[model samples]
Target: MSEIKHEVTKDPITGVETTGHVWDDTLQEFNNPLPAWWLWAFYGTIIFSIIYWIIYPSWPTGLAERGFLTGLSTIEFTSDKGEKVTTHWNTRALLAQEMQNDENELKRQKMVKEVAATPLADVVKDPTKSAFVLAYGKGIFGDYCAACHQSGGQGVIGNFPNLVDDSWLWGGDPADIETTIRKGRKGHMPAHKGTLSDEQITAAANYVLSLSGEKVDPELAAKGKEIFNTKGCSGCHTPAATGMKALGSANLTDKIWTQANVPGADSPEAKIEAVKKIIAGGIDREMPAWESRLSNDEIKVLVAYLKLLSQ
Candidate 1:
């Protein structure tokens, strides 16, 4: 064990003594003088603070210092008959009013009508107009459809269809597109977890490919056909089990698929996976309503664009 010792060292400038104890083996420190530059810097800061307090806002009073600007310019109100001067209104409020007044001067109702009235063909064909509209539409797409549909409008397939492609699950009419955009879309495929066995789910998926000119696995098709009719697919899918437009149940017989459309996916083996998920989990796609987020004009433009896409 090291023996303890105590000593006191006075500060060189202030003359205050250290507390009669040392902390470590080699290092020895004591209350000491502040550097001349530091002491001068401290005094300079104090002087600067006093000057700032006199010339600018500070504690001890609510009044603004003489040099501080409160943004309330002295407003002169001219008399109607040149008699009395009115009170000074705040400059900020006046600036705000002026800004609002000037803003309307640029694009008032007249300008919007003038812009919208231009024939859509003229707008679409013109690069300037098309660029402006596309730029505008990109922002709208991000806010409304980007949640379920991706930022690029490439939908999360097996649930939603790709808008870039030709296949449309529902009618691709402009009016239909508009209705779908405004209202939203929901596809109903009845759940068959307990209604059909794992074997049946596998078979139904295989049977789905036969409609698309894909060869069927004989063993799977035999089992799938029995499950399809017994499970009442024909109710919504019609007698041929092709499709029923009323319920929007897809025509399993068509080559155009609204769901997954990978290359060689029409094959029974490939389709079986898709069908199994649909039968076991059931597919549900909900496209949110855009009535609240977008203006009627914006919706109209979108409707026209979607219509043009299908063609």
Candidate 2:
């Protein structure tokens, strides 16, 4: 029987070589050594992983009482002081205590007084003080007023007066505004939509515009004037179509719009919107009760801002 012998060759560095075998008539696989950089990187990773495992809470420890000893036994981490450090997190409680603490009482009271005494314009004029007041106001406003007043203090007209307007349905006194804000306010005006037709509404709207002293389209206002009396809108709006605060009926005669007034529609448009809102929603404006929601000091800040609006 004929014998076939295997061939071998020594590698240059590792001194290792593959069994003598060739494919595709010439191709051969070689045994090679890994580069120093690659070898070192691999070792480094292993060492880092070991260190990380030791320092951090990994395996469970039986000595749970001693921070480090318990942690080490349980494979948990402990501070240098040999105690387990725990995080402390709480909110509302801290705020409540901070707000009422004897020391805090004076600070909180002072903050409220400052807010009440300071006009909004003046408060805003200062970068530092205004920023604090604004942030403080925003939280209070959102927490208490956002439900009815909306995020931007924009209220539903006829239901809630928009705080943005120059013509305030109620007197725009700061203290008064604060009182109205803190305590819920309800305004009632007889809905005129039922009695007034589209035509009379149009006419009365025009006349109401004239009350604002702004020039109205003579033709429309003339029509509006007739409807104003015909619809008996004067019963509550008065002969002048001016508001009767007693009934919380807004004075239609003023130029300052209580709600969003469609520009060109003037009196007619404003009346249409007001009438529609009045009929659909009924006259109910509520400034939320802050007694439960806001601290006494927070309400004072609100009063301050409101006073600034009028001043």
Candidate 3:
């Protein structure tokens, strides 16, 4: 085999050094140096990557228990039990530290404590407390109540009760609202299908609708009135059809419906059918208790917020 040789030369035309490589005995490769800026930029990236790896969690450790390389960075935060917790740097720990030190977060905590101690009536009267309740309570309501009552508290037609409306199954008083949030409510209307005939149920429904000023057959409504009083309906709803707040019975006099979608019905027949279906099937819905989930102060804020919304 012939010995391979390299010949380095300079081209007089461009005055650039040759790479000592030739092709086709004419074409020569130039030995050009890389730009200083490009070289520095490449080195800077390598340095940045090394620094990043040293400051944050990067490579996974071979040991399963150790997980990843935690790096040199650390975060300190006060735990709920008042213990100082120093852990490896993480987003959750960073947030906790921020919550403890943030100026706005500190102010919010102070306001929460102040609101918790104040009377519900006084809280509504005070401009500062009332404003806080409306602003802060909106977020709380959205987090918890909005899932059922909707974002604006308008409520779903048949699924949830409208908090924005004046009509309330339970009393709408501040104290009443507080109790409701703490204890929760279970609405129950026994099904009449087992005891009452189809005609009797229809008559009762028509009578119930008539109480709300809905036009119905006078003869059937009169018959229904008799059945309503005689049957157990009066026991919960009361004889006057004004409803008993203590029992969470719906007031028949008010046209606003909670369980039955009476307002949604287009035609008179559909309206009658809607009410009749409710009478036959009955209702069993519940508002879950928040006492365990939310703090007492949060419940108070929610009460004030809901009361304000209704107004």
Candidate 4:
């Protein structure tokens, strides 16, 4: 093999140094240094990366409990229990610190305090407080209540109650709504499968449908009305077929069907079957109490928020 020649030269045309690499005999490669700004920017990025790694969490230390480098940077914030907490710089801690010190957040806290002090009725009446309750309460609802009641609060048929409608199992009063969010509610309907025959159950279902102005069999409904009054249903539902809020009984007179998906039924027979199924199988549902989980102020905001939704 022939020895390769290495040469360096300067091009006289622009007076720039050449790498002495010829492509087509005359054409040469320029030995140009990187631009000063570009070189400094590159070095600056390197320095920034080093500083970032030192100040923030970066390298894995391979330790079990303390898996990563804690870094030199620290974040300090007041915890929920009113205690000062200092920890390694993290987004979560940073957000907490911001929430504590941010001007918008401070205003929100002040508004929450005002809402807590005001009565439920007054809170809804006040424009500023009501607006705050609606906006803030939406987030709270999405976090807590949306899981069960749905994002729109329309609820699931045969499971959760539709909150947007006028129909409320318990009373619709502000105090009642507050109590519901605080204490929670349990719905119970005893099975009549053992006591009443299938015919009686069907008749009772027909009567219930008729109460809601559904075109049910008159003779069957008459028989069912008797069974409804005598079979201990009227004790909670009342003789008028109107529910008692104190007992959390559903009103039969209303077109709204909470436990039974009667509205969803395609045919009249299917509708009757829906109600019959509830009567025969019985109903047992529970809404978990938020009193322990949520603060009174939060619950108040939720009550107002729910009321606004229903309206």
TM-score of each: 0.56, 0.52, 0.85, 0.79
Candidate 2 lDDT (Cα, whole model)? 0.59
Estimate, for each residue in 116-157, the C-alpha lDDT of model 3 and write its tens digit.
788878987899998998999999999999999999999997
lDDT of 4 by residue, 57-96 (tens): 9888887247998789999999989999999999999999
**Residue 105 in candidate 1 has what lDDT?**
40
- Candidate 1 clashes: the total is 1
RMSD, each candidate, Å? 11.9, 9.7, 2.9, 3.7
TM-score of decoy 1: 0.56
| Number of clashing pairs per prediction, in order | 1, 12, 0, 0
Worst 10 residues of 3 by lDDT: 1-10
Q: Is candidate 2 or 4 superior in TM-score?
A: 4
- The candidate maximizing TM-score is 3
Candidate 3 lDDT (Cα, whole model)? 0.90
**1 or 3, greater by lDDT:** 3
Candidates sorted by TM-score, best first: 3, 4, 1, 2
Off by over 4 Å in 3: 1-4, 62-66, 182-184, 215-218, 265-270, 289-295
TM-score-better candidate, 1 vs 2 = 1
Write model 2 residue lDDT over 1-311, tens digit each, in one string: 33433456655566679556555544456756699999999999999877766654444456544333212222222343557534222244335444555686656567666765676667668666665666667777677666766767766643456665545665666656666657756665555566766666555555665777655578977887777676666777688777665555677756655543434355654545554454333465445566667656677776654443334
The residue pairs that clash in candidate 3, if any, are none
Give stretches of model 1 more than 4 Å off.
1-133, 240-245, 256-270
